[model samples]
Target: MTYQRLAYDDAATPEQMHADCRVVTALLRPAPSIRFEDYPREVVKPTLEISEAAARLATALHLHLD
Candidate 1:
């Protein structure tokens, strides 16, 4: 028996790439100062769409680097 490999293509426009960067950055953000009062300004959180896009981008990166 032979194993089949998954193949995928990851390409995006400049705007889309920016959005994806935001998503991954948001996801990887360090825990803020552990305080209820001293909090950072609120910002729109990244969406599920961006998370998925970032995941796809990471997979593509790993595959390409291999």
Candidate 2:
């Protein structure tokens, strides 16, 4: 038996890339010195989206995920 490698292309417009960057940065920023039991719910979608985008970009750039 032989195995064939799958291929994928990851490309994004400059505007989209910038937007993703901003989203990730905002999520990673230090939180305010306030009491909070949980993170904001609104940021969940953007945070996941940015994470996926970054993973794809890293793969496209031939970066090792490990």
Candidate 3:
């Protein structure tokens, strides 16, 4: 959960983006009691991936949870 910026290049292809999104979501979605800060620095890319997945999920579900 540490606030490290995602390091992947902005020009990453759609496939890479999708894979990253899945990895991040998987990393974040477990252990409901775990805070974001409990995650390690190496998890930043996955964190960004999770963020993107969350945004997409919200949009797809027509949710305004953000």
Instruction: Show how many residue pairs clash in every candidate, following the order shown.
Output: 0, 0, 3
Number of the top lDDT candidate: 2
Better of 2 and 3 by TM-score: 2
TM-score of each: 0.30, 0.32, 0.30
For candidate 1, the per-residue lDDT at 12 reads 80
lDDT of 1 by residue, 4-66 (tens): 765966578999999999999989967768885786668788755446667788887884322
Question: What is the C-alpha lDDT profile of model 2 across 1-66, one tens digit per residue?
Answer: 998765965688999999999999988968575655565445544333347778899999999665
Residue 21's lDDT within candidate 1 is 92
Tens-digit lDDT string for candidate 3 (27-60): 8855565766866556444333347778889989
Error of 1 at 17 (Å): 0.7
Pairs clashing within candidate 3:
1-36, 1-37, 1-39
What's the residue-level lDDT of 26 in candidate 1?
84
Best by TM-score: 2
Clashing pairs in 1: none
What is the C-alpha RMSD, rounded to one decimal, of candidate 2? 25.7
RMSD of each: 26.3, 25.7, 25.6
TM-score of 3: 0.30
Total residue pair clashes for candidate 1: 0
lDDT of 1: 0.75
